[model samples]
Target chain A: MSRPVRVSPQELRQTLIEAIVEVAPDVDPTTIDPCEDLAEQLALDSVDMLATLVSVNERTGIEIPERDYPKLATLDDAVAYLVHAAVRQVDAAARQEEDSSI
Target chain B: MPSLGADMESGTLLEWRVKPGDVVKRGDIVAVVDTSKAEIEVEIFQDGTVEQLLVAEGTRVPVGTVLATLQTTSDESERAQAPSAPPPPTEGPSAERPRVSPVARRAAERLGVDITSLHGSGPNGAITLADVQGTAGSTQAARAVKPDEAPAPSVAADRQAAMRQAIGALMARSKKEIPHYYLQSTIDLSGALEWLGKANETRPMSERLLPAALLLSATAKAAKEAPAMNGFWRSDAFQPAEHVHLGVAVSLRGGGLVAPAIRDADRKSVDELMASLNDLVRRARVGVLRSSEMFDPTITVTNLGDLGAEVVHGVIYPPQVALVGFGAVGERPWAHSGMLGVRPLVTVTLAGDHRVSDGAEGSRVLALGGRYRQRPEEREK
Candidate 1:
């Protein structure tokens, strides 16, 4: 049986920074504070936020719904949200696999 | 038919925003098209009932191809009463007119040059500004002229390459065909920035206005005062746009530029302009621009402030008679009331079509833009 791969917070943070850079190349990802509000610090507008979300989704294969977008206000918050979502997705897949096997 | 841009030879019809039997009015978005740069929303020009969609979605057709049939108010009733009556003659070669860029038409008017007497040197033998300007009193009606031909279908993959090719074609044509004149003005932005600061202080972070919005608003007002710099040069003369739809240039994330029009810039408040500009920039980067926004801009405003440029002398987008460019705004030593003081200043440059308007008119537009900046409150009205 194959086990689901786990995404670490550090890896997620790197992914988030890469995604942000994809949307706004002018932004210096290294200077971004993990806990600071991205909109306030980087002047990331709504469009940039959407682009970042799309890029992260494409990179990580994780879907972040619009309703949950408000929870992802900072780099740290996004990393945490992504980690939790990935865990949930893995759990759902495992449960479905177990039911199918039975 | 709408020419989205000079580089766009053909577009693939993506989807219809309005279905058959739907009533559509002027400026109403009816269809969406996939262009070389982005997917733009296409708007119709007249009030009518959509009789049928002539072209199915996903079909790549050349520019000037009719994608749909609209029955005007009079025609709708006539067709309803006499279903068997032969339809009005289709718009065929007999009704076809010589293809001439709007700028060429306007230039021909100014120079009193007969455009029909000259051979077109532009793509598909379309009359260009240079062709009109080059042919003065020469009875060269027999000049070898090529017939109009459809541009070859572009490969959908490698969007960046297509974009580059499109940009190259347009820029090359602009530089080669248009006789451009440049004008520059140093505007004192202290008053405008002061007002913006106060206004932003009272607004939320997301709603706070950017300096670019103020500059755009001032440009629109300036366009209103200096009408010559505010419209398309077409049909042998300058056709001043009834409304100021300012096209703001935005750089995409994947490396291309698109300028979508902010409709009725003169009528909108600064806050409204800010919201629209933000939305337009976001959509432009995301590649979801509407067709009307792509083709409706009568004038273009490019702000290179964020890039840290001190001045920008931009090339005029074809059909558009003038392009207004703004450079970085910074605190500089200024002489107001004969006293030296630090004030925010920005260098404004206007690249105008010499055939349509001279440097004098371009200077007037820039001066008006500066004057509007001093009275920033008037923009809200």
Candidate 2:
């Protein structure tokens, strides 16, 4: 899938918060501090954290590999990683489509 | 009808999946029964042909009431006779038992309670599990069967209230009848977490393992080591169980909770336990649990830590002599090898029935659980 319209960093953060809330219904979105460790702040266990990442992937179409999990310690970190990865993914999809057209 | 829980007195038959002349095997979901807690799918224990349906849809029958009559199936069909006018000979060890609930009869047989001398306090003066226990212990066995029982409510608010009452009855009974002795220990989880991280590094989200699985496995393994804390307190004595059927407390999304047993949990590995936990939680919330899962828990383990609780002092479920609880694993001040530092630590607690065991035996359970968690690689079973 191609994302002709780019998603902003703010939107990515919002998506991350929503995903976290979905994984942990007990967690309050308003209480989340973007700079702090999300797992620690929200009491997200390993399974909860993994589920949150999966929910994020489903929403943004950005696959966060297991190796890159450490990069998502905080909300800001996750947003930055997703924003960068989405751009790379969109660029790759665009190039592939252009090649197919040729 | 199966005694789904200690709090259950009667259940309303919702639907019958099997009809007369249909064949059913052991573990087959024969019918759905609605208790105060949830809608449970009742399973038949013996392979037999459905001879007749004794109870109809929407009939609220008390525990031990025969829902249907089954003619035993066998290879020797040549000797098979038509369904006789008289009731077929009762099958299994509970056969020919008069005035005793099936579950209570089984408990009596196990606990060596002389049913002939005791008087039943149940409906029609039938010998119930509490009656059998009363004969064995000095403490009064709580009467679970309510005489003026209300109909199963349909609305969510009413259902929630009903669940609250059910839980309240059980908890009050536990506190009143069982003299509980509690012991707590702080377990270092740095080693376990490190191992889990390395183990999950290459796996996808769906295949990854959770710390709760490890804790449960450890508790099951520990129950095996601490035999005194692994069985029921019945007939004024401790009846040690042969297998570790670990009860897991799963809270529903709507409201309230159910603690169902994972049979032979000690025999399962961490990966298998994780899979079972996932499937169990899914089915439990959806309210389609099996009869055996509801009835056969030898011990219970509650992990309130998953929801961010720092510590738990859980009440022991009746008949089961012990309850194991795990709090959230958090970074805490630790001293290791003469150095003070912060480490991921979990506070594990054991609530033991004083009538059956002492604090030393309870401590052994926590100690063994701590060892297994601190050294996950050594958890062979």
Candidate 3:
């Protein structure tokens, strides 16, 4: 209903890492491999993964459907997915705004 | 510091959330304590106004030491009548003296061991029960205390070692004392999974339930039905609990495990259990669980499904009489209504204390759990 907040891939990646650290403080951001499965590498359980995802959604205001959770297994894939979702949201918001003005 | 676990001998007081003159009720978190396994928020167990804090922050003290003094609300009338009762000494005469644990002091008094003449081998040169007992056993008790041990290792590595020690000690005690018997049953979970999938279709991502929630709730409900498996073995006797508090064994991110309770699990719905389970796991991982959560579990449930374990025969935490373990739910050949077919199944195991319960009670618990789990739709309420 409003303008979607656009985020660059690097910023989205940083946001994901921050969210993870917020939930599991023992996680060292420096040790994370961007291409590796985040949960398995960090030994995070499903609840931790869900909390991290929820924190990310709270920070970015992105409505990540549950079906898309598997696509976010790795940091690189998560950033790419979020970046594309942000662009689509922005486009949809712009079209809606234009229609309302008419 | 109150005992956070069976093996927690002492804890370092990290910070006080409340100060003198603050009013605290039962279950209010008053301080944070750093144990070997995790940093836990210590809760007050009575309604009172804080009068004085005996232990300073950053000081490590043994369990049962008086950390703070409180003015109970119930004693108002007594205080009013005896206004001159010497204000209950703020500090004892032995304050600022030897750093001896309460248990060690008692042992010293009983065994006629001179505590002041000996060096402590415990953390920060604090005397422990072992130090006193060893001294009483032999003439030589002056072990060199290592106050300035080599600069401490990384916190994570140090914690890992300490956690392993704590778990090993408790497990050894369990194995040596309790006669444990294990029973395993494979439950057909096709109905529950099907019900859960349909239920999730109408909910949001955050509210969607996991299979573990169903397993936990079912175990809780089953324990309520099978009372023999729902209590503790204390004081050389079996004492059944009034309500079902299921201790959820959560594995930490780095290592170690803590089983904190979800109070009154049998009364909660599946959705409610899921929410509590999510919150409990989150808090347990963050190392901020409350004191009662650590102490109030009547029974424990360990789920190793995520790790792909087929079955778990958990060691019963001391005092508690039973442990329920749920393994991975996978497709397997099964006979349903006399027809052979492939179905989703889970292996549930029960480890019961032979001193308190026999195999019949353990079987009843597993059977009831399976029944509850089979009817996921009915439990949603």
Candidate 4:
């Protein structure tokens, strides 16, 4: 079986920024404050947010549920959430691989 | 029979929402049609029973082709007998025989005016161009215009290809047919932005306004002042639209773009327009749009600000005579009181049909838009 891909926190943050920029082309990633609300700072509407989520999912192969979108209100929060989610996904896949081997 | 838009020669009947023998009320969505732009839900105007389905699904027919037969309570016999001859082919129904000239009929159809509501003033009680225009203006004032797709994770490549072809055809037709005259002006949006910022402070994040809402409202008001710039140029003539159904160009995440109408934009407040625009952009991305919204735009508005463009010279979406474009709103050196200072400026461009209006009228429209932006409070009024 192939080994699972590894993603670091900083890498995840960059991916998140790219995703946000892809969704809203007008937003400048360098100008975004990590702690500021992305919706207010970037003027991201619900549709824009949805597109961002889709972009993140496509990039990281992690599906974030709509209910948990509020947790990703800021850049830092999104990065942290995505990193944790990615780790958990890799761990779950490893466990399944072990179980199948047994 | 619905003429989805001026460019649409025909639409494919994708599915029938209502089956025969089903009871349907006015404003009920009876069928779904796949137009050149998008799949649209078509609504029926008369309350009736579905007598028969004349045209089956998957049939691509021209505009004004009768799709189904309806048995109405008022004229049950006549309608039931004359199933072949459906009411005059237009978006809305004109139940009775309204005395309207051929030109007037075409004008009413293009303007989304209900002929039955108009009072005829011509000889033999016939409705003329003036009569239609008068009724359209008054009807707009009298009527208080009160006004989602499944998660497809993977973008459909075929849909994108189809949309690209459709857009190419439409743009080609536009360039070939319309004599377009372009005019642009840079407006200082400092006042508008300041007012918007202050106004947004009290509102919730969900209800907060975007600069697009302000632009749309301003364009609608400007169109109201310069009526010649708002309407369809069809049948070798120009028909002015009384109400401003502003078509907003929304880019899809996958590929291509669709500009659906926000019906009666001048009548709606900025906040209301924001809500409508949000809904439109969301649905447009998801590929679920109503028939009326697809076809009803009197003029089109495209904002390339998001793309960071300084100016956009857009092609006129036929039969719409004008297309208003708003480009990047950024800080620029300005002279307000003979003093140089940095202010937020937006380059607004108007691409008008030279057949119907000239640069002078287009300039007036842009000036009106700038004036409206200067006084943001007037947007809601």
Query: Chain A structural similarity (TM-score) per candidate?
Result: 0.90, 0.90, 0.93, 0.92
Clashing pairs in 3: none
Model 4 regions more than 4 Å off? A1-102, B58-62, B76-158
User: lDDT tens string, model 4, B121-217?
Assistant: 5433555555565666567655321111111212234445556777888899999999999999999989998888788667544566777888889
Over the stretch B1-381, how does candidate 2's per-residue lDDT look in tens digits?
779988888888766777777788889988878887767888988898887766667678778777777877664322233322233233322322235543444456555677877786543455655566556554334522221111112344566787899999999999999999999999999999998989888765667788888999999998988888788877778899999999998876446789999989999999999888876764564455778899979999998887778889999998899999988888999999999999999999999998888998788778888899999998853
True contacts kept of each: 0.09, 0.13, 0.36, 0.04
Computed on C-alphas against the true complex, the DockQ of each candidate is: 0.07, 0.10, 0.19, 0.04
After superposition, the stretches of candidate 2 with alpha carbons farther than 4 Å from their true spots are A1-62, A65-102, B74-154
For residues B269-327, write the lDDT of model 1, one tens digit per residue: 88889889877875665456877788778889988765568899998887888899988
Ranking by DockQ: 3, 2, 1, 4
What DockQ score does model 2 reach against the true complex? 0.10
Q: Between candidates 2 and 4, which one is better according to lDDT? A: 2
Q: Pick the candidate with the highest TM-score.
A: 3
Provide TM-scores for the models. 0.64, 0.71, 0.80, 0.66
Model 2 TM-score (2 dp): 0.71
Error of 1 at B115 (Å): 50
Window of ten residues with lowest summed lDDT in model 4 chain B: B144-153
Would you list the rank order by TM-score, best first? 3, 2, 4, 1
Taken in order, the candidates have interface RMSDs of 14.8, 13.7, 10.5, 17.8
